[model samples]
Structures are given as C-alpha cells and as structure tokens.
Target chain A: MSTRLLTKYATPDESGQAILKNAMEKLDLSARAYDRILKVSRTIADLEECENIEAHHVAEAVQYRSLDRSGWAG
Target chain B: MLVKTFGAAVTGIDAITITIEVNVTRGIRFFLVGLPDNAVKESQQRIESVFKETGHKWPGKRIVVNMAPADTRKEGSAYDLPIAVGVLAADEQITSSRISDFMMMGELSLDGSIHPIKGALPIALQAKADGFKGFIVPKANAREAAVVKGLNVYGVESFREVVDFLTGRKEIEPVEVDTDAEFLKEQARSEFDFADVKGQDSVKRALEIAAAGGHNVIMIGPPGSGKSMLAKRLPTILPPLTLDEALETTKIHSVAGKLNGHISLLTRRPFRSPHHSVSDVALVGGGSYPQPGEISLAHNGVLFLDELPEFKRSVLEVMRQPLEDRTISISRARFTIDYPASFMMVASMNPCPCGYYNHPEKACVCSPGVVQKYLSRISGPLLDRIDIHIEVVPVPFDKLAAQKPAETSNTVRERVIKARAVQSERFKK
Candidate 1:
C-alpha cells in the first residue's frame, strides 16, 4: 500500500493509538513497522465490518507482529 | 515484386507487430536484414527446405526479407511463417490481395507442418487493437488466440493450409469462444479447499485476512506442521480472478510460452510454488530474452516460497523492488521492459535448522547460535514486506482423526469477498 492509502484508510482511533503506543514502548519496533500495524488493523476492522479501526483490532494486529521468530513459538 | 505480411515479437508481456516485407530483385542469394537474430536469419534455410520439400517453386531471385522498425531485434523462429508467405506471395505462387488482412505466427517444420508459437494471445489482442481482419496461429495455440473477440482467428495445421486460406483456395472456420462463459464455468472450482484440513483455526483466520487485504504472509513452524499445506490452499479462499485479471495473468503466461498447452483463460487464482533453488533471474524475471519469471507468472495470484530461508539471499533480494512497486523493470544498455508482478507472497520457514525449534512434542536439537543463524537467512527487509506472521503448530492426533469437516474455502471466500467489497467501497473516492 502507498503512504497516501495508508494514512487515508488506516488511521487509528484515540484508544487504538494508546494500544500501539504501548506496544511500541514494550517491543521496540522499527519505525517502518508502525505503518504496517495500522494497515493490518484496518484489514481486521474491515473483516469485522467495523467502519473505524478499534482498539482490539489494533491489539490483534500487534500480536501478529510479536509472534515467535528468533525465540520460542507462541 | 514486393509482399508484406505481419507477425509479432514478444517483448515483456506484450507484443509489437512486425511488418515482414519481402522484396525480390534480380539475383540468386537471399538476404535477411532489419536486426534479426541468428534464429530468425536461419529461417531462410527452413523456408527453403519447406519450399523444396513441398515442391513449390522457390523464388531464386535476390530475396531481401526485412522485419521493419529496423531497431527492434526479432528473436524467435515464429517469424518463419510470415517470411515464408511473404516470399511466396512476392513470387505470385500464392497470389492474394487479402494476405495482409491477417496477422500470422508459426514455426515451419522440415516437412512444412506448423508448430505453435509463443505470445499468441498478446499477438491476437494486438491484432484486434490494430483492426486486423484476422489472426492465423498454429492449431495448438488456437484456444488462446480465440479468447480475444472481434477478430477472425484461424488455427492451421500446415503451411499449405495457410497458403490455401490466404489464396482463397479453401475455407477455414474462425474459432468462436464465449470467453466470459468459459471463465465463469469453472470460476468457483478449487482443487484444494480449507475443509480438507483437519484443524488449525487461527492459521486459517490469518490466511483469510491476508487474502482479503492482499497482504503478504509468513509461516514459521516446525516440519510437518502443515505450513506448506496451508500455503498451497491460500488461492482456494482467494477471491476468484476477475475477467481483466485473468486476461492479464494469461497474457504473462502466454508470452512466457507456459500456456501453449494449457487452458485459454485461467479460471482460478494461480498458486505458484517455485522451488527454493530458483535463481535471481528465474525468481524475478530477467534473462537474455527476459521472459516473465515465477513472480510474474503468479501475478494477480499467490507466490508461495516454501522453505523461504532455503532460497539464496540474493534471489530473495531481487524481489524487493517488485514487492514495493508491483512491477519489475529490466534494463539493458539499449532498452528496458517492465513485467507486472503484483502478487501476494506467502512464505514458509522452519523456526530452527532442525525443523523442530518449538514443536509441541519433539524437542529442538539445534543450539541457540544455530537457531539464530537459521533465522538470519531471511533478511529483515524482506520479512518487512510480509504483512502477517503465522506460527503453525501441528494438530494433535484426536483433532486429525475427527471425521467432521472443517469450514470450506467457499464459505471463507464469501466473507473474504464481502471484506474486499467493503475495502473497494471505502476506497471509492
């Protein structure tokens, strides 16, 4: 997705913002990962028929990014 | 005498019509010009042999056959038919005023039989766009050429048939196809479905989301955890290819010579799983002639890289440009060609070298340093292109033994389609 589409379609809500902010603090994600999380949350919200990105949708997408890779499988 | 016939040279996924102009003057030798490669120049021998074998009087005059638009290098033997016919018509052996009404492409055999040529669909499309009266391709490529409407398509078996058709000596039926109906006939059919799997609801959900959003995915798990199996079934739940998407995909396949013997239109989303040993050129589309590679073959579909880390890092690196731009551009010193490669990349890798890093039952035998080494084979930049990460766990024996069928891909596809509808509506601005 282009940056224009990313900002237009996947901007998070206030509560969703805090959830992402918390995850960023905890996980030390790269700056590039911030945009992907929003895109995925937008998809999750779309799947659930939500017009706006919700806290839980952002939370779910965040969890996918934290899945075990160099560590133990979650 | 001068004769003009038409053929095409496939550059990238499209074709440019090459005018085969044959001019016969007072001399004995043949001269082929207009930047033709060795294969095209060698068509003189094949054309001569076909004339001799079929007992057609050869025009012993100086035959200067030129493929016009002098800079474009004509590469293949497919130009054989047009060149042969141009020579024959110039000598008035096949005297027809309507010869230029059709675009022709086929390779001639020693005994004058016709062989299939590549890019028949694109050539057919270009012919229709150029308002040609017809397209004459080999019998084997008829179905593909027939996919295009508003043009006469004649599939011929031998050079004799072409001559007869052009000279009005015989009538050949133009191929008729209801491509829309043909595409819809098998649109919903899938060779593999989600219901075939016994368990793993979470993994299925991730794949569903990925399909709905056209997002890339990565599967990390131990061996025998159903990663490859799940990756193979991703296309089943993908929304079926639209008519335009199918045509685009089929054109790429056609120009690559991969669809000569396959169906004219691809009804389902393509699921291509090239082996990990694929080279940089084969993975991303580059060569001397520059054929569409596996990624372009998987356009408007899925490209599953099974054992992702097993692929050479350089091979993986070449995909980064197409992943971002949705198209790959190959540039030589003289020219450049771009092939469309918009595809969902679904890749898989074991969590560790021993393939059991976090198995539910089997203990991982690889050391910590070894596991890190295995993970680093896939670079971070490439991994960033993947949108979703799924950790596949092997289903237990009881779950595998359950006789109840899981949710079918058709059912999942409904929701996926619904989700995509919402996306399109949201983006309708």
Candidate 2:
C-alpha cells in the first residue's frame, strides 16, 4: 500500500513566539489578528520551503496590519 | 402534409426542447395553438410577412402551427424561423426530408433575415444532449453556440440560406471554436492594473490577502482616495478562471442576452458595479420570470459597490443570503431555480456624510454621533460577512508625482496564486 502524504506542517517554535508577542504588544493586535498572523506565517513558511515557521515570516505577516493601527483614525 | 421541427425554451440558464409542428389542410385560415405568449402568437404575422417578402409560397390551405409540450410557456419570437420552416416544409415549398435532424431558433425580420436569439449556448447544449444532429441559429449567435463541442452549430443569415441548405442545394459548414486557445489568448490581456494607482500600498496588500483567501473586503475612505479605482483592479489579481467556470459564466451571460454578436467564451472575469439605486429584486435575482441579477452575473468575478451606504438598506439585506450560500434560489409557485452567485464582493464608502470624518489632514464637519450613524447604515450582518475593513488614505502630492512606478498587478497576482496553491493543497489534506 502507498503511504499518504502528510498534510500537516511544522508549527512555530520559540523564535516564532517572540515575534508574535512583539506584534501583539506593539501593534495592539486583536485575538483574531493573532490567529490570522499565525496562518499567514505558516503560508510564508510553506512558500520558503521552511520546516518551521520562522521569526521573519511572523514579522512579515504582522506587517500586513497597516490598517489595524489606532493613530490613523484619530 | 405535416412537418415537425424543433426549438428550445430557456429557464434559469437551462434549456428544454420545444417541438414545432405544422400541418397544411384544405382550408383558408391559420390556427396557432399551444401555450404561446403574445410574442410567439404574433410569429404568424412575421412568418407571413417574411414569406411574402422572400417570394415563398404562402399555402392557400388552412395552416395550423402547434408548439409542444403545451403545458410549458413559450416566450419570445425565437420560434419565428422554426415555425416558418415547418410551414414551408409542410407546404412542399422547401424539402422536409432532413428537417428532424436539426433544432432551429431565430427571430425572422420582415425581409426574411434571421436575427439573434438569447440562450443560444444553453439551447445548443440541450440539443446536443437530446441527440439532435445540429442546431441552426442566427449568425450572430454562432460563436456562442460553437463553444459547445460534439454538436454541429449552423448559423444562417436569412431564410433563403436556411432553405438552400435544408433543400440540399447548398452547403453550410458548422461553426467551431478552439475554446482553450481562445481563452488563453484573452487571458493574457487585462484592462485594469494596480500599477496605475500611484499609492495606497497598504490597501493593495489587504486586497491581495482578500483575493488569495476568497474573503470579502470593504474600503472606507474620504472622497478621491482611489477606493473605487483599487477595487476595480481586484479581478486582475485573482486567479484566472478555469474552463468549467468560463462555460458556466458564459451560460448565465448567454441566457441574459448579454453576449452580443460574434462573442465567444468570456475569458476575462466580469466586474459588475450596479448603481446604488438598484432594487432588491435586481440585486439578488428575482422577478415574475426570474432572471439572474448583478451578483449572479458577477459569478466567478468581482462585484464592486461604490458608496455602499448609499444603497437602500432593504436591497443590501437581500444580498445577505446569497453572500452566504454562494447561490441565490428563486421560488415560484411552479418551480424553484437557483442561479450561481459566487463572487468576490468589494464595497467602498466615504468615511461619513461630510466625507471627512477621519481624514488625516481635514477636520470632521459632521456632528459627534453622525459618523457612527453613517457607519451603521451598512447593517451589522453585512459588515460581519466582510472579512477585511481597510481604510484608504489619499496619496501625497510627492508620492503621486514620484518617478518610480508602483508594483504591477502581475507581480501581486503571482504571490496571490502561490498563496492560493498553498491553501488548496492544505485543504486537500
């Protein structure tokens, strides 16, 4: 029997956690944005052929929240 | 003598075959029967006029034309050519030996020229399914019907040409379309691109995400912030349509009579921006004879709503269900039909009534709570359905006059395609 290809990818590690914490504190991102960030980071990792979600991927994903800033509306 | 030929009736983008039978008996009056609407009943006048104009014999005997099954309603003058041909064959003015092999539909002018009919694609599809050898349609609808393979589509310009072909006196080659090559050629060209927009890089990034994830987006900004300009370019970033999607979209457009002469497959995705004053029935697809609406017409493409709050609340409310289901179902006492309404919604609106509620450099003129009131015009449910809410700021004079061009749509589309590929692969698991 042929083995099925695994669909799941590797999760974020410690460096990824630091990036997320930095974005949440600095950007004041919502819980929804937090989840979206992780998903986008995973995609970025997939694009780069990386086994784990890297810190740079998380940083790039967080940068997408340009509209989420509080100062622009005020 | 009695003769039988065929036509079709379109309902909700599908077609049902209609058989037209004509018999010549020993009398002087014409009798037309079988559930024909005013347009179909009036075909007798057109047919007689066409016969007189073309120098064809109008049978002196009693001529009766019947369209079966009598239970279904036959609308439009598409039956003009079919009934005329059946009468001619029955009167022995034209050969009848090979009449049953083809299904014919077209509107006949007084001078006997054939006019285009709607729903040619669906009718051709039904004819092919019903084992008809060929479909004879107006020359204008030839390319539309040619999209269907395994069916001989003969397009004629006038009654004389049709008679010449049916009598074996002349030959008419069936229209053929290389659907794939045509689709690829058309896909290479796009009318709008992101490179034209001077700035709003943040909004472009948000739209890229929305396109990649199939999420709906809303852009709120002051006037002249380029919200509408940005929304129009979203289709170029989304993935090109597959063949099945092109056919499905073409069928809806064909049934709507939106495909004009010599139009082949619609390779580019549609961008429909109906005015804000559109009614509830027009936006979501409903009527006595239910035709597809803007949302359904925008199938597999983008539906941009500029000045979203300017739309009547009830009209926006009607769109909520289709937005969720990706298909709008119209229920009548006789039948229920669903039109595909799957599309990317990109709505834009000014920040407030004064149009400068949150402008970076302009002071708000509206009252304290007026901005909230304006925002509340778009219902909570509709806002909830939209995943991304972007704020667009106008580009500065320096940015607008900058020497470097902004990123082109092709570059953004490449990343969107890659992201979509990743998502589909993930979903497969």
Q: Top model by TM-score, which number?
A: 1
Clashes within 3 Å, all models in order? 0, 1
| Per-residue C-alpha lDDT of model 2 across residues B1-429, encoded as one tens digit per residue | 889999999989899999999999898999889888899988988998999988997889999998899888899999998899999999988775889999999999999999999999999999999999999999999999999989999989999999989889999999989888998999979879999999789888778877876777889899999999999899999889999999999999998899977678999889999999999988888887788999999999999999999999999999999987899999999778889999989999987898987677998899857876787788766765665778889898899999788899999889888877876776676
Q: Each prediction's TM-score against the native?
A: 0.97, 0.87
Which one is best on DockQ? 1
Model 2 misplacement above 4 A: A1-74
Q: Which run of 10 residues does model 1 chain B get worst, by summed lDDT?
A: B259-268
A1-74: candidate 2 lDDT, tens digit per residue = 01122213535678878978987897787665666566656656655556677888777766655445444333
Q: Model 1: residues >4 Å from true position, as ranges? A: A67-74
Candidate 2 clashes between residue pairs 3 or more apart in a chain or in different chains: B27-B62
The lDDT, on a scale of 0 to 1, for candidate 2 is 0.86
